[model samples]
Target: MICSHVTVPVMIHLKLHELPAKHVLKRWTRDARDIIPPEYLRYQKDHGPLKYSSR
Candidate 1:
């Protein structure tokens, strides 16, 4: 899943051993923020004239 404004790139590479539904959710929740680029935080704070898509 790609984040709004193209700030984050999330790739899900699942191995057969990690197929459990609960484990998948846990992994995704744990790593979600790490996928986002640092610059995006700055942009969010600025909230200047530039407008980003909300998706």
Candidate 2:
């Protein structure tokens, strides 16, 4: 007898036209928090607003 593991790819669907900016931002923050450390949160927060600014 042999044991085998199978992997499946899951597809996610999103309709951006129906989503609000605040909703998107909330999701982004949640995802980012999982990958970023507490000490870096302040730097990350600043970058979000400055991203659009040339200076």
Candidate 3:
């Protein structure tokens, strides 16, 4: 998972490595799950990068 790669415990708890809350937060957060497929990335390499807001 993305959390495992980060230096700090961003997504999950440090001790248990679980979600801190049961429900989504009401406020908008920059922290979000982003998964880009290899095919699309390769295409972008030859072509230009896509103007995507988020994944």
Candidate number achieving the greatest TM-score relative to the actual structure: 2
> lDDT tens digits, residues 1-55, model 2?
1112311111113323343444345436556566776666667654554334567
Q: List candidate 3 segments past 4 Å from native.
A: 1-36, 39-44
Error of 2 at 35 (Å): 1.3
| Stretches > 4 Å off in candidate 1 | 1-30, 43-55
Candidate 1, residues 1-55, lDDT tens digits: the string is 3343432222233324333464355436745555657666554443465657898
The lDDT for every candidate, in the order shown, is 0.46, 0.44, 0.47
- My TM-score estimates for the predictions, one after another, are 0.20, 0.21, 0.17
If ranked by lDDT, best first, what sequence of candidates would result? 3, 1, 2
The backbone clash count of each candidate, in order, is 0, 0, 0
Candidate 3 residue-wise lDDT, 1-55, digit = tens = 2334562455444465554454345233434323445555655334575666876
* Model 3: colliding residue pairs: none
TM-score-superior candidate, 1 or 2: 2
Error of 3 at 54 (Å): 7.1
